[model samples]
Target: MQVNINGIETRYVLSNEGGGPWLTFIHQLGGDLSVWDQLAGYFRNDYTVLRYDLRGHGKTALSREAFGMADLSHDLASLLDALGAPTTHVVGMSMGGMIAQQFALDHPSRVDTLTLANTFGGTRPESRALWEQRAASVREGGMASLVPSTMDRWLTPDFQHAHPEAVEPIREVFGHTLSEGYAMACEAVRDFDVRSKLGTIRCPTLTVAGRHDTGTPPADTQAIADAIEGARFELLDAAHLAPIEQSHRFAALLETFLERPV
Candidate 1:
């Protein structure tokens, strides 16, 4: 469950049922590997699903020093090597997407395909203060205080009202998140900028966007698709956490795209 990787103890779950190409899933800022549990089960019959907690979230240890996207990306790479996986398909959402892009860019040969969903290549310059504000909020009120506003941003009101139970995991996981880890990661997400380098990623890529997601709007996701040659973009009828809100549809799209392209 935990491996000493890149000088940090990384917590991960590797699905046992599937033995095909490794399909690594990364969670958003506040979430851990469980963020992908639903999709991992869906793909476990065919693909080896590897999901893990980022250094500061879940049971994984926090970074020893101030970190960057590259540091986070390398954590994924090293974990795969430790697991003896030579290459893998990388799927990342939100903050995880930034790390995935960094992984694909920094270690192109190791990435079989890239799936960026409900994420952006970078935060706008004007949003720097906003990121700091979030960091402050978490530092002051902890994750519990962020649940309501975050839920509003992640899930639409209708979905929250219709299926309140579904969003509870996020609340629970997020509530328990380490403030230091959250703040460290928030700063990383805040200062992250990979837009100029998105063009360098040559792997088969798919970008998914939540049409109603204001956090990372359709335009932002489309820019990533536009930058990456031959990358495909799909718009889903959900909010920021599209995969959780529209799990079946997102899974169907991912399944179709990942089918051996021969």
Candidate 2:
């Protein structure tokens, strides 16, 4: 379904399931709501799962210029308000994780629990350099140039070799992405630094890390877990897209976490 959030037309798929708390899935950079398809079924039976394209992604309209993390967080807040979701358990991956952090900081009362997967709390020099390279490449060659590199980070060699079906959809997503939207997201990541403020997050938190992830290493997850008092940390033997590559384990962990008493 579509809703106007802060003047931008946002497209979201809301699961009609009732009786459980609402769960929101936020995808990584260059990704849309479809990225969560692999794990959505696991939650659909119990919870109201809301998956939507971030601003400037999928069917969501972009702003006139580039955006910051705060803007993205506000968009999320607007989405929750429009949906009349009093509170939600937010799960975010990579760049989405950064936005989730900011969202929790900005709208504490609206968030029930927070999960950060394959994400970073701040911009490290190495990551900054990589983002710069990707930004440059996207500007010059468009989104196609991002495919091979992104694929390498997203999936393990064995999984890639075994699942040929996954490649085409990923390629389609990459090919159809707007360079400007991606570049703007990269700039948001470049400027993001919330290390000092992570302690402000009061919601119960979980941090999931992909052991083989080069984009946001296990150390990043550890940092997030440590920063948030009593946050649970789990490491999966998968690449960056752990939710896709290890859907069962991811779903199980999330189910266990969300089902726990507050």
Candidate 3:
């Protein structure tokens, strides 16, 4: 479905009718709501799962002006408000994690719990450079230049070898993504830095990382966990997109986190 939130048309997919608490899933760069497909079914029996494409990606409309992390954060807050979910357990990965952090910081009262997976707080210089380079490439050649490297960064060798079927959907999603939207999101990541404000997040937090994740390694996840007070950190034996690489374990971990009393 689509909704006009804060003047921009945002596209989202919702699974309602569950009796449990609300859970919102935010995908990383080069991803849409469908990125959460594997993980969403696991929570269908319990939580109301909401997934959406950030502006400039997937089915959402793109902004002509350059966007920052705050803009993406507000987009999410608006989506939640439109859905009548004032507060929810928010889960985000990679770039989505950055948005989730900002959302929690900006709207503390609207976030029940925070889960960040395979993400960073922007403490590394090299990672920032890499993101900038990616932005430059996308602006020059569009999403095609990003496909191969993105696949390498996101998938584990074993999973890629065992499940070739998984590659096509991601490829198609990338093929159809608006270059403008994808480039703008990359800029948001390049300019994003939330390390100094991590202390401001008051919601219960969980940080999950893939032990084999090269894009955003375990140390990046540790940095986020260390900054957030009493945040629980766990490492799964998967790659960057752990939720897709190890769906069963990832879903169980998320379920357990959401079920825990805050």
**lDDT top scorer:** 1
TM-score of each: 0.97, 0.95, 0.95
lDDT tens readout by residue for model 3, 113-232? 999999998736656777777778888998887788788788877888888888678777977898888878888888888899998887899999998899898998888999988899
Top model number, TM-score: 1
Clash-forming residue pairs, model 2: none
Give candidate 1's whole-model lDDT.
Answer: 0.90
Q: Please give, for residues 1-262, the per-residue lDDT of candidate 1 as tens digits.
A: 9999988988999995868889999999899888788899999989888999998899999888888898898888889999999999989998998999999999999999999999989989999899999999888878888887888999888898898788888878888989989989988888899899888888999999998998888889889999999999999999999988999999998898899421
TM-score: the better of candidates 1 and 2: 1
RMSD of candidate 2 to true structure, Å? 1.5
Ranking by lDDT: 1, 2, 3
